[model samples]
Target: MKERNILDILGNAEEDTMEFLTEKCPEITDAELDALIDATEKKYKTKKKAKDGTEKDNNINMTENEVSGVEHSRRPAWLAPLLTAASIVLTAGVVLGSVMLLNRHGHNGGGIEQPAVTATTTSVTAAVSTIATSAGTATGTAAMSTATTQTVTAAETTAETTVYTTVPFVAPAAEKLYVDNELGSIALELFKKDDEVRYYPMGGGIECDIHDGIKFAADPELDIWCIDYSVEGDSYPAVHDIAYYCHVTDSKFSSLEEIKNYARRTMSENRYEQFFGGKMAKDIDNLEYMDTIDKEHTKFWIEYRGKLYELAYVGGWGKLPSVFSDFYPVIIADKTDTSYTAYIPLWYIQVEDINNCICVELKLILDPEFNDWRVDNVEQFDGKHYEELYNMLKG
Candidate 1:
């Protein structure tokens, strides 16, 4: 074709597109467009060369020339140095972003861990404070209770100590109590001093004058009631039998010395210093004697009898296991106290068939029934028995 004719079509014709640059561009030329295409081709060659390396190198060189072109358009300087600086800043930003991301992840993880640690610490501290407070309160209450107990114990001890220090008063030791009789004579407080004038060893009731010569008792165990004698309806004396329990304030008691002197004047003043003769008396270990001699078991005895039936005597009765004497009276020097002077009888009288004291014993065994009791027969008494045991003195 004609080159001038092709140039004419190049200005505004598609037919000139396939034609090699016929002449040169009039305004914008085809040579410049081809130079741009060559530069793009060189950048593509660099991208292809980076495909053999790591992903970082591939990504860095993939658009390195393209990035340099962008920089070249902004400022006309050494684009390679500018590209290096931008790459360094981008690398620093990537590193800074990674650090920030790691820091954010650490903060989120630490947030999860902190709440649990704080809750546990707070709970432990609260438990420790509660335990400490409880222990302190318990210790304080225990100390206070101990102090209160000690104070109460001390007060009780002091009160007990003060109660037992003082003693009661007493009457003099040389007086006597007497009663008026219907026969117009005065009868003194009389106690039979015969140590050997009883039917039972530890048990014997009192024997008063029934008429002229005979004497007897209804209840023989409780002898304290017999001391109060009445002259047939002169106020009717309280004690009518051997087992009668007498009143304390109703009867007057002489002083201890006066009682001993009066007993000596009214009764026998001597004691038996020898043993008796009999088959059973020779060997006194027999239990048969224990049954007959128990004052708590028997009814009555023939007074002033001469034979020693080991069952029949006086003095060794009441709470004491063993004692002697016919007189069992509660002497009242000071009526309220057992520690005062008591005229405790210490001998038994053996009454034989006759009305006389036959045998004397210094000591006699009391019945087991007498433990913690004052046996009195007034509750079940029959006055008809007075005539049965009588071995009277017939004038």
Candidate 2:
């Protein structure tokens, strides 16, 4: 009989036979069988003496040695491949069994039932699903982050673009007053109640109602006076309707002499000289000074070059310069209170030639809180005491 290769025998074996062979000799392989055959041939060529003084073939001992050598050398090399082949066989068997079972129960040749997936395929599918889910979560988180950033940016932009408007101011109705003997005794008595101010003569005179529009400060040591007043009506940009009333008053001295003496004490020599010798002196020359027993307040006005000009003086403080057109006669009225100075520039057309020249009238408003003023929708008058003057000037 022709010799058959062991690999061929295994390949052609029936399933039952192969299983039986595998169970009986699990470690046997074609290389191991070849080693056994080689050992047998060597054993036959070399005889050994047996215990009975007879020569014997050591084929069985040689076969045992060959089997041990093969196990030591090849066992380590074959283990991974054997495991991999066994796994492939097991997976294939499982798939084949499932397909066979499905085919048996499936509709006759019209439809085939899908085979159950193997463990490896199922594991791979599960891994892919997990990766897909993770990607989706990452995408959602990125989108949410972008949306939040946009919302915050939009809110910041709105804040930047929003404009703030100013608020209007209301006057105080009453304030406190201080009296000093050095400034000379005045018969007027002042007091405040609920937001209203009332004054009357200590020695019986006309009663007067006033607002907290006036403020007064005097230094007997320096013989200086600082008075602040607030005015009603519209003002120019950064300008307030207030006036700074400052001067010195002495009952024993004449008004002009007292003003000259104060100027000498407070002003530079040049300034004092310039004031008396300049246009101010000429303007003073044209003014008419009048006093009344009912109100000790002095009033000054002048009709100059067909225009009427006025001096504004209140309380015991001296006069402030005028800024309205000379053509418009202005009467000094109740002055308001403030802490800082404000300026309003008044433009007037010359009466001589209405189109020839434009004059600027710079008026000062003194308010303590000048810096705190905010521009709002409030109307400002040219001067609080100038309604009659305005009418006359207009005429």
Candidate 3:
């Protein structure tokens, strides 16, 4: 038998002849079979058109079956590709059927048994459908890439906030003393004396006669006093005056020299000049004058503003009939007037015979221009005398 090409078998051979070609060419693929079928159909149509004497322009007027010798069917022009693919499938089916039958008859006993033609054709058709689906997926993926190229933006903004703080109020030193009731009471009670001898207001004249043969005479103009009394039956007379005393005792200086040393050490040259009026050492030295009390006891005094003021007692006694007790000094600053004042408590002897004691008040004043406070005024009173004057000074 002569070896025949697959295209020649498809062009003019009948079904029996195609089966014979498939039996001869067992390795012919489905793709080669589909190409052979397409070429045979084109050749058959061209021969048929020439046999009917139909011109190429007149072929368009012919019905589907009349042009191809098949059943007439209406289809869209876009389905041309589908129709061509279907023809390829049909040709592949024919080749598969031939291969299946040859295997059933055992003509090639040594060859592997082939799958059924319907199964093979179904698998080929599925492969074609899968390729079409994969192409559609690739197109969808391209569209997705275009859609994925997008961006987001945010706007810039600003905010502002404010905060406030509170400040506490502090009262001035002078105003604090006047307004605070507790502080005023403490100031007033500082000089209050215990009741033993009562105070009596004098009228008409300074002549007053009291018990123990004591005579009291007062100079109302200067608030001075002259007292005559007998001590151990010995007649004696003394003159006294109400005067401001230095109030630095609260600093707890061990001695007068310490006090003077502190002033000298702490005060600047200008401050020393302003305070002592250029009489720092000399005046302070001269101010240390002392009066003898029968050689065994003595009384010390400091002269200021042309008057003699005695030293407050820490623990001592004297002949002038003065108080012997501890004195505590208090300093107060008045910022409203830029001034400072010090109150010195003068614990004085109450009665010459009993040794009872009371406090006499002394005040020192300092202005901003002065570095040291100057003894300014004094108030002497008891549980009885000068109550109104004490209250006025208290305020």
lDDT score at residue 75, model 3, on the 0-100 scale? 43
Report the lDDT of model 3 for residue 51: 37
Clashing pairs counted in every model:
30, 18, 1
Candidate 3 residue-wise lDDT at 254: 33
Clashing pairs in 3: 199-384
Candidate 2 segments exceeding 4 Å error: 1-253, 274-310, 313-395
Candidate number achieving the greatest lDDT relative to the actual structure = 3
RMSD of each: 61.5, 52.1, 62.4
Give a tens-digit lDDT track for model 2, residues 1-395: 12222334446777643432222111111222222333333333332212112212222224734542222222234445545544553453343333223322332110011111111000011001110111111110000000000112455445442111011122212221122232111101000010010000000011111111122221122211111112232211111111221111213223444434433432233423422222121132332322111111111212233332222111110001112233432222123342211112122211322222111111122323333221111112222212323333335
User: Which candidate, 1 or 3, would have the higher TM-score against the true structure?
Assistant: 3
Give the TM-score of each candidate: 0.12, 0.12, 0.17
Q: Against the hidden true structure, what lDDT does model 2 obtain?
A: 0.22
Model 3, span 117-143: residue lDDT tens: 110111011121110111111110000
lDDT of 2 at 299: 16
Candidate achieving the largest TM-score: 3
| Candidate 1 lDDT, 1-395, residue by residue in tens | 01122223335545333121211111111221222233344444454444334334324433735542222223224445544544553443343333223332232110000111100000000011110111111110000000000112455445542111111112223332111131111001221233222111122222222211122233234322221221232222222232211111101121223323322332322211111101022122232311222233222212112221111111111111113322322222222211122222221112122211111111111123322111110010111211111211011
